[model samples]
Target: MALTTLFPPESTATPFATFATETAATPFATFALSSTEAAATPSSTIAPYATALNGVNQPMNILFRNAIWWGLGVLAMLILIIRLMQRAIAHSRHTAAMGLSGEAQAYWSKNRYSTWWKFKRHMLYAPLGKKRHNREIRLSSAGNIGTIPSRFHAILLTIFFLSNLAFLAFLDYSRSDRYSVLADLRGRSGVLAIINMIALIIFAGRNNPLIPLLQISFDTYNLMHRWVGRVVVLEVVLHTMAWAIVKHAATGWSGIWHMVGTNPFISWGTVGTVALVLILILSLSPIRHAFYETFLAVHIILAFIAILGTWIHCEVAKLPQLAIIKAVFILWLLERVARMARLGYLNYSLKGKAWTSATVTAMPGGASRVTLHLPRHVNVKPGSHAYIRFAGIKYWESHPFSIAWVEHKPIHEETLPRQEKETPVEKQLREPETTTDISFVIHAQTGMTKTLYEKATQCQPRQLTLNAAFEGPYGGHHSLDSYGHVVLFAGSSGITHQIPFVQHLIQGYNDGTVATRRITLIWIIRESEHLEWVREWMDLVLKMPKRREILQVKLYVTRPKNPRDIISPSSTVQMSAGRPKIGYILREEVKAQMGAMCVTVCGPGGLADNVREVVREVQDVSVVDFIEESFTW
Candidate 1:
């Protein structure tokens, strides 16, 4: 019997049986049905079969979604528990060491409990390769291709990728018609794609609530965003291909093309798929790094188009996946709104003071020191950065710059002029005059930075002041106050990030509020002239009372003009002609370790990797923690 003869187009009695018979003739033809034909076809017979299919699919979708949420919750819970346990341990050790002499303190440091220390050392903190965690794999001096993921990150990404694959291939085909099975596969892929979009949007946001709750860095979230975006693109491509295959098999190439041209559902879906493919293409590491601003602008535009197309496609198709799309859209909207609010609040002055202004001063080695004079006080801390926009230069562009220094100057009534002090209104207002000066030392690497440097150099005294606006004081809340020993490593311009930590920790030590007993700052620069970048700040830190007792500064001139120029200023402030041996320094620090040690690095990829490796190697011998500050997006 002819397969089509057994199940005529007019039949409506048994939809599954009919579909089975028709599909049996040419299983590929199942997807070729035109929209008109599909609409004209009887639906009553297929309703029961679809309900049966849903019995399997609905639960699977629910399970997968719940699994993602539960996974995040569990991870967050584990981090919280670990933090509490560490605090408890620190308190216990502090109490025990309070009465101990130097020898007893040393003994206690060596004998402290460390059940999870080994696991963290070998698995959590360990790099994919030995000692290369934050270092980028550069294609050349001008281009950094990427960096290796930590072992812990690698494991999580693997599980996430595999889970997505499992969900994509989970459709059952037992006793089901080929047409029905193919349709089920298409639906599953589409549903999964929509679901993954939630994660894609969440991780892309700067104000992602999960960051603080889970203690994950923005760099890690950026990594997750890229991977999740790739997965979403893959699922979208699969979903589109499945539909195309079925359509082409059912009718012909012409019929499928005709449907796409005439059918809103097919046309909108095709548009979204095309946009997503373009996003994947333009987001390659090389292309993204080469034309970051252009890439970012286009990426945002294309992403919006893709989302709008998908929303419309779902609406016209009446797919249940619209709920997921709605959720993703809401998240994207919320992030944008929050970002705008932050910018407005941070930049606008309401107290009749002038708007923020930035003074750009050219420095040696193509770098600029930008000082932002703010109208109000800002809570400045170590490790903080801000996104700054220059209204007179490039109003549309905002770049992240680390806060290198923050100064607060108080206004005294006695310092006011005699005429102003005589005013009755001025006399009634006795509040202290306070202003904040936030500064960033930015290296001229590309676009806006290069322009800023050029403009600064053109001015007399190589400095220019311009109107500007800035958002944040973001990041920098990572605490090093609990550790007794702290080691900071900075390379070239990366000193901007580490300087604040040095200042904050030293102040804490002076106030007797922190557990820190020792601090070592290692700064590596290309030329000896680069030392002038933080000269004033370093002088202030050096002059602090009791600084010599607790602080040690090491300067490494990697490419000095004259090797003899690299001279040690003092015993505590040492200078070297080449890179310091990171491993050797770490080992020595570990030998004389205090209660606990914290190793931090914000430098070139090579330095970060070296520091990471050294920390991992000595983790088992001491209670050590590593924190790396990087902007990898």
Candidate 2:
């Protein structure tokens, strides 16, 4: 009675004796405990009946026992049938191979071996390459396609599931006499459960260090970061549920309350649970997440709370490891914050002190270009970008621009006189070791570029006091090493980024530093005039030997001028009338030139999406050969 109340109460309890004795109501009851005992009692009438074999109970028991035998019998038959089918298929293949010519047979055998090696090689190398290709393998820690950071984590999860099953089996075997099943949670394996929980946390916390590596793209990276937090939340919920079930069966509902209050681990668990629930509610499709600015703020707060809870949950003893994790995330956060602060300060200080003049020239088809004048000896790099602040805009955050030109220091010939007293300022005026004219193509997009175009065309000889704070040279666009071919995919306005990359490729090829066999440039855009913005790039690609010898150019125009336009040269200079399909572009157009070929793509949303699609499709492509760069943050 006490045991009954501890579980669910005596009223709900089903007695085995009661079940066995009610034989008139149910036939199964005759074999139940009470009925069988009564039949076995040594009364004259029952003793004779017990010895007799002709009875309904005998038939019923036999039928019940034979049901298990029938099930196992069917399973064996099914397995035998599958084996025969596989053998038959193998026989057909052998029969066909017997008729092949000697040379053909040898070639097929060699090809088969080569195929096996290729498949095996990819499996071995996939993880090493996954580090470089960061985005593809990033999955939610809860249960997304099983990201394996440590081989140990994967093995642990498998062991956890199996061990729990075994424990459940043990519980069932122990209770076979009573026909009672032990609950899943009561049978949970402690070590395996702990291992699974730890692995889940490790995978969730893996991103604490990756922020800095993805610098200047906070908006993009934050999306993934926030979602990872979401996954962490889900994992914690499951962890809590597992504990809930275990506590309930062992000591009833009161035990749930007792376990929750007494456990130190539960304190952290509660914090994590609350934060996750709040975040999930706020992030619902109908709520504040719909507003980008508000969502960003709330997301950051929730992230902090969740991480704080995680830190406590892992226990204060692991602070050193936790600090290392936190350090990586904090360092990157500090860097972005510091840079933004520096830019803001410069914009204010340099506003009146620098009375600089600038020019804005209108290009064909509604695009305009602007150049800012600084005190002349300002250092800049060809590929480096800066945050630009123009006059008359307060609270308009600085926009990113590539350096177009910088003053070059003069070098003296042997015949010329050498000057003394080269002051620190004079030395500072000297050109950078690797210097080139700074340039960037401005696309008329909806944001800052559109504002720039409107203001520049309207103003006359504008006395613009521009303050620029540089943020990069973050990406290594031209760092081509150990590659035989260079392929660049640039969408409309993405040419600014790709042109410098291609130019570097051509220079490297001519200098013999690069052994690139081919340099193919594919540009996707809407207007032909947009090509004029990067005509210098087009001309260079056309003239370069590496480009001409191995380089091929394909231009795709989604919106063409005439109805007769085709993608090939014979028609309107456009490769295709519709948007370029990534699958088609890579397989039919790019794959022949794919081996040891590096693919770099940059552009708008559509272009980035297309490039991502291609990259995903070619999951088997060598990681060294694929590079994706997005110019916009």
Candidate 3:
């Protein structure tokens, strides 16, 4: 009896599957057919997976793919468990610290060393290399290409990357062109590339539900998106190269071009790969940073084009992986729709109120202070940020800003008239109100920020008002209230992120709601003139109930014009001229050794790395948790 391939011998739409022989001992024998066998099958088939070699008779690629996903899911569960445990430990520590007698504070200062604590500090939160994790590796004084990942992030990425490499070789090498292994590799890579696209889109969006669910920051999601995208691109390249190599062996270059010119599957697949290649090239650190707005616009457009081409390529051949691509498309569309809906709801009040209005004031330095009045009440957490869209200036673009301050004002049920005639006792029966007022201090560097500053400077009183849109309150997942001692380091405009935390902890201290006993703010700015940036808020914080008892501010003006300008404001707030000794401050703080210290820094890459270096070095002396904040593309 003549043996026939399960798929038509001439079927070009075999989803990269190619076989010259139909034998019972082959890897794809499970789908084998004989000349006298059964019935007609579908014209287009997608057999993209690896099977056992030598004597295997069944296709096991599907099980392998499913296993990959299951493995990832299990890993996520493990991470989730670890995170929850950390939070629980933190809560218990906070509770104990708060309940401690004056003597207990000193007694708990000497923490019991454990292998677990060392691992958490040295490995889990450690930088990828010697000390340059968060600091952007700069090409010049103007810009930087990128920063490296932390140790934990690097390890996870490495493992996943290596696994993909391993999967590409899970086929028989004993077989020749008669049963091409190249075709199998092509199919495998294609499947993996398409499968990973799901995660690529999921992590790329700003409104990813996983952020809050996993208690991970957008910074991490953004990192994951970049790495996943790179992997997808590499797989796609390999898939294309494998196909080209196999076809080249069968037919010459002219024949290859002929098929690409006529076959929609081949043509569209090429288009998708080309578009992705362009995206990868232009997305490099230097190119992206130099032309951020252009890069972003082109990036979005190219991404859509690639997805469209890929979908058509798969659909034309009726591959099962089309479903995966469809899910990716749907997810992308849903995220965009959700973002639009959120923007409309937040910026436009349904009760027929005005759109969100923004007041922009040009500060003494090359900075602008943006005060946004949301149409409705907003709950702005400490260390949270927002993406702002200025209606008049590049309204299509949005920039993320750390919310410097937030206030709440009650829209009382009863309003007193200018000439109130009501009894005083009657006015006391009003409802409780929520907090209001949101503000951001933005330093002008380039692009939108520079334009905003120039526009504000042109206006009367060096301030301008316009309509705007707000999207966020994201990235406040880390809480400092759990620690007895807290050290906040800010470089330049990085102060915006720390101000809200200062206010929250001070207020929490007053209300007996937090365990924080000592709060130190170390702000490093270039010039003394920058002090005007947070003068008003600093005044308010300084006046908080029992502020001096727990709060201290240290200002280091790196470029003070005169010696006298660097004077102390009060006993708690001091000013020094020159860059701070990051290691010195961290060591002194650790030596004082309050119960469970938490050191967080939001600053220039150099400052963050410096702080991280010291934090890592002194972890053995104290149970210190180091947190770094730096957002990258």
Best by lDDT: 3
lDDT of 3 by residue, 152-204 (tens): 89998998898888877675555423224555567678888988898899989
Worst 10 residues of 1 by lDDT: 47-56
For each candidate, what is the lDDT?
Answer: 0.75, 0.44, 0.77
> What does candidate 2's lDDT look like per residue over 433-472, in tens digits?
2122234556655555666676655666522224333333
Q: Best-fitting candidate, measured by TM-score? A: 3
lDDT-better candidate, 1 vs 3: 3
Model 2 TM: 0.48
Query: Which is the winner by lDDT between candidate 2 and candidate 3?
Result: 3
TM-score (all chains, Cα) for each model: 0.86, 0.48, 0.88
Query: How many clashing residue pairs, candidate 3?
Result: 4
All predictions: root-mean-square deviation over Cα? 6.7, 17.9, 5.4
CA error at residue 416 for candidate 1, angstroms: 9.3
The CA lDDT at 404 in model 3 is 97
What global local distance difference test value does model 3 have?
A: 0.77
